[model samples]
Target chain A: MTLNLEPLWLTLKLASLTTFVLLVIGTPIAWWLSQTRSRMKQVVATLVALPLVLPPTVLGFYLLLLLGPAGPIGKLTEALGLGTLPFTFPGLVVGSVIYSLPFLVQPAHNAFEAIGSRPLEVAATLRASPLDRFFSVALPLALPGLLSGGILAFAHTVGEFGVILMIGGNIPGETKVLSIAIYDHVESLEWTQAHWLAGGMVLFAFLVVLSMNLLGQRMRQIGQD
Target chain B: MIELDVAFRLDRGNFTLDVAFTAPGLGITGLFGRSGCGKTSILRCVAGLERAAGHCRLDGETWQDDAKGIFLKTHRRPIGYVFQEASLFAHLSVRDNLKYGMRRVPASEHQIAFDEVVDLLGIRQHLERAPSGLSGGERQRVSIARALLTSPRLLLMDEPLSALDHASKQDILPYLERLHDTLRIPVLYVSHAPDEVARLADRIVLMRDGQVQAIGSATEILSRLDLPLAQDTEASALIEGRVQSHDDNYDLTRVAIPGGTLTVGRLDQATESRIRLRIHARDVSIAIRKPETSSILNVLPARIVEMQEIDRSHLLVKLCTAGEPHPPLLARITRYSRDRLKLEPGQEVFAQVKAVALMD
Candidate 1:
């Protein structure tokens, strides 16, 4: 039987979009967390990491309630001329971003924190403006951490199942991602299709984790050298 | 004229820094003190890197005035700082590191060109290499070159040579000496090494316990027998002079000091080149009568200026060559000799110097 590739495309799209958005928003948050001495830093960090420990369905449930017609975000979106996002692709993307946030932010935060204050201070004495220093010194040195964060976030988003189910249900091209598709195959007793998809996921997850370990090892070598 | 006037008070827990001093803008002004005495704090204040309650003015420009509530940030100030550890940007090549500051200044404001700075620092071969691969001395050279590329109005060096080994320090000393000879940028060098201060400083600010103990010309301050620098057993005086002539036959060189000429071992420098001679106190002996025959080759008529007791058995005497505008010299002798020769201030005597140390 010819397999429908719509779910795979949707999963890739969702993963790519979520990874991009998380990187854009997570970078500054991670940087702030790394540099701040304020008491509020731990509070903010805990909130970000809540997704890692909290059930994805719990986050998805809250997001579903918040994105429903009666909720504030839904009301605001409706007022802004956009309809409510309940079981749509946009709702799935929003759920994926929240679920995968900690994966992206923690690595970036650690990377930025690994760089102490000396490089920035040296840059300052050399007449580098604050923005210049961030772009030139901070970003280049923390590149490995940022890459790890992005890869983990992408992989985590692709493997997401419960969040998408709770927020988006399984609406074919609009919200049906790979994991939900695989679940649907197994529920219908399609054992062959389930095995094919499950095996693909296992291989993909293994490669991604291997690459992360390799990147970490390479960074450590560079640091020692 | 004074180029920098700094008065600051920084309170960081138990370590409090209260200092105020004025130093000339030309040549190197050394901030000499022991460790943790706030020498680096003063330098950080001058560089505008650290904010404390104080007033710092550079060449009549107010960098920070606590009374006026004005403090210029480090980037806005025209200053170049060399950190103790040679904190070069690891990501950038040597060329890019040097260009970081150069690009900040407009072309018209560039006093030293890139080629000139590279040649001066001898980092032309290291341009494309990353800082991680360079030796300690090479890294420091690049750091200095990077600071110079900024065309800074003031250069602040915080023990730039302290982190290196003796060989690396020796490797960088000539380049530093060349920098001193070529650049007009006023250098505020922080160092705990007395040799560095004596060799490079035009003026010295003696610091102890976060306070300015003394500030004056290098020769005047270093020769003060009352200060800790001169009170030590290794205390010596810096005598500025020029090479009068080099006698190849006797393998000796005669240096022209303010009062008279000094004959020393052979020197490689040509005649008329300036030289600094270090005269240790212990090498000098005072005699009431001039000795006609003695193994000592250098002896000059000197009048005692001041005599102070160094210890129970020994005395330190300040002497001036018996001539107009005489430079000061130190003679460390026994207290018994003082009573036997009836040595007193203003008494004409001969100072027999056994040996003079030439500073390379």
Candidate 2:
């Protein structure tokens, strides 16, 4: 019920870090989805977007078991001297990354789809290796998609309460992100504290969306030529 | 010597592309065919853009062979392909588009100089601009220059000017002419337009339905009356000549054909330039004697080599000229004109050229 800024800052920090990590992993997946034709591509595509459509409650329930002391991931980490993953900030990051995955992937898929095969072909003839082509031509052209995906992932992760509560267990500084903090205020009938935290989140989300729209317009203009 | 015994099979619906050809070394060998005739597929196969069953050997180098397990990747093949569109990188400037190819080739072995290509294509002014800003003709010029900079053993161009309007095609043609003259590397030019083949190709490979229908000098196959395309309006004898002189004042350039000299609009080109002239079959009329009074400047006394009915109404007559030793000039006259003149096989006649289109 008390006004505490730590949970909000931790949530923001977690969302930012998770978004950065997801962009690295999501970029290649998006590019492959745009280019690959193999039978495995279908399976990979389904798996990447699976976390988006699956019920978050059910996924969180399963994650609770998977990261528990007796679970395989927990035991593996404990044996490796890292201890358990549950009730931790890193655990919330892992949960948020899985929950907000489709946000990162879909925008990038659309971006990669918009680029023509011409620049890549020109690159090949010019003696650019495939890696060079990806870095020099595909990555630069697909930047807008990446930017939008990263923003969506970060905003969605910041607002996530269900998965974080189920696995992270509302541990104060370690796991109580802003959304969990607002929910705690509501549970205790602390209207004033909830209003301030919720209002800040609303303002942050608006700015992100507005800036994202501008970024998309700039990217679309660059893509047109 | 550049040798190609390449054959590839491609299936598209009911249409199957089964093409094979062997090209002589040097200059340009045109892959001539109609739409959907697998001309582009053949070029793609040569460039390793498409995989085919057949093997290709160029100057004893293996580009593809299913049995030998040698199929170079598209990027690994030392080839330059100019697609129907310029296909230039829209994001890169013209200079970068050119650099795409040049940078790939090692500096020690690169035969094409950067400045030379820029000058050759007349793209120096446009180098800083992106491909989107360039005109269709300008884009194509850059495409040609990009391909040239690759230092390819074989260059493949698939209908590079098909997207352009007539004015653009005209503007792009002279650059191709210059490229054909300066580059000793073999080029495979794919087009359905007979005029393009006549203008630039030293040798023509006529393809019909995924098969090699005819292969010889551009003049020989073009003059044949039996082929469906020979009945076309542009169908004529392709006469090879050396630029004897160009008169600026009169606005005419004289070219010495086998039987006699022909002149057309003056060309600003080097003297002794090899040029091809398309003498329309409909333009030539048969005469038993040299006419004393006539407007046509090109009239050569010749013997009829052969005659065949191209269709119900058109008759194709072949005439032997003095300078052209290999191929004969074909004159397509109406059957009505043929019966009236009593023009028969092996008959001596005076051939009058109505018009001649000189090609660089």
Candidate 3:
């Protein structure tokens, strides 16, 4: 049987979209977690990290309920003339973003925390307004951690299986990502196809982990210098 | 004028800082105190970095007024602050760090040019380099230059030299002296080093235990016998003088103080230029009569103003060389000498100087 690449293309698209969206939304959350002294900081941090420890199926089940037609978010979307999100590409994107959030946020949070408060205060004394300081000083200093976070988020999204299965289901072009396609091949006893996909995933995982280690070493060298 | 009347209390009541003083708007005003005496707290309050309950007015502009319920944030206040550490941005080059504040300031309010500050702090060669490549002294110079380029109305320095090594501190002091000589911005300098304050401060506000101990000219505060500074072993007296003439043959310069002139080691200053002399208490000796032939150079008639027992063995004697209004000279002599001369307040004697340090 000829191996179709539609599932691989779909998986790459979902992972890229999820990584982009997570970086945009996770940055401010990480910054707030690093800088705030409010009582709710721990609560917010725990909520962001919930996807890290919860079983993927459990998380996926809750996400399904929340995005289904009868749920609150589903109802709001319907009221706004947008259809409910379940077994759709958008639903898969949402699930992947939540599942991969901690991968992005933790590194970014640590990076922002490592900067301390002195540079920001110095910027303030130099008459840099709040937004100017954030963009000019804080962002540049935290770029390494953010890049690592984005990479981790993308890698983690690509490997996710249970959450995608629960929320996205098996739509060939829309939600049949690589992990689901590999599972389908194994269920039908298509050993050759499964081996090809599984071997590619192993190589991808190794490359991602190796690059993260290299990036971490580079970050440490920059810190020492 | 810079006016600060602030009261700050930390949580758990472990520390409280209450101080009120006004300093001239022209020269450096040193906040001299020991560590934990709240000098840095006062500077932070003036910069709007630390919130305190009081009012701060800088050159007629109100920075904070609690009674009026107005508190200006730090970025809104036109003040430059040099922290104890050289906190330059790690990601920006020296040029970009200097321009960080200069770019934010409007052109109409730009009083200090970028090139002028770069040359002032002597950081021209390092402009293209990153902060990490600089020595401690070079980094601090860039930090100062960065603050200056903002053209701030007030400059606040919180022990800017405290973090440097001895060699770095020496390297940076001349640059600081040049800044003082060339710039017109008022500075509030916080330092625990007495000699640093004595060399740089025109006026001083002494703090002890979170209270204002005294506020006066540096000369008065340094020489006051009752204050803690005079009782310390490093106590010295400051005297302003005009250069009279240089003795090329002896390699000596003659400086005319209030009532008498002193022949000191050769100086590079021109005739008629003002200079400051720092005469340590230990270097001064008292004599009942002037020695006719002696190797010592400076000897001037003075009357004993007051005497305080420094310890069981030493006595710190305050003397007036030019009478009232002129700063007094401190002589740390053995109690044996005081007894031998029968020294008493208002009695005439001679102060034989052993050394004089030139402070610019």
TM-scores of the first chain across all predictions?
A: 0.98, 0.94, 0.98
- Residue B184, candidate 1: alpha-carbon lDDT: 86
Off by over 4 Å in 3: B1-12
DockQ of candidate 3, scored on C-alphas against the true complex (2 decimals): 0.90
* lDDT of model 1 at position B25: 77
DockQ per candidate: 0.74, 0.64, 0.90
Interface RMSD of 3: 0.7
State the displacement of the C-alpha of residue B200, model 3, in Å, after optimal TM-score superposition: 0.5
Interface CA root-mean-square deviation for model 2: 1.7
For each candidate in the order shown, give its overall lDDT on alpha carbons: 0.90, 0.84, 0.91
Pairs in steric clash, model 2: A126-B100, B258-B322, B258-B323, B258-B324, B259-B322
Per-prediction TM-score to the true structure, in the order listed: 0.93, 0.93, 0.97
Pick by lDDT: which candidate is best?
3
Best by DockQ: 3
- Which 10-residue window of candidate 2 chain B scores lowest in summed lDDT? B321-330
For candidate 1 chain A, the 10 contiguous residues with the lowest summed lDDT are: A1-10
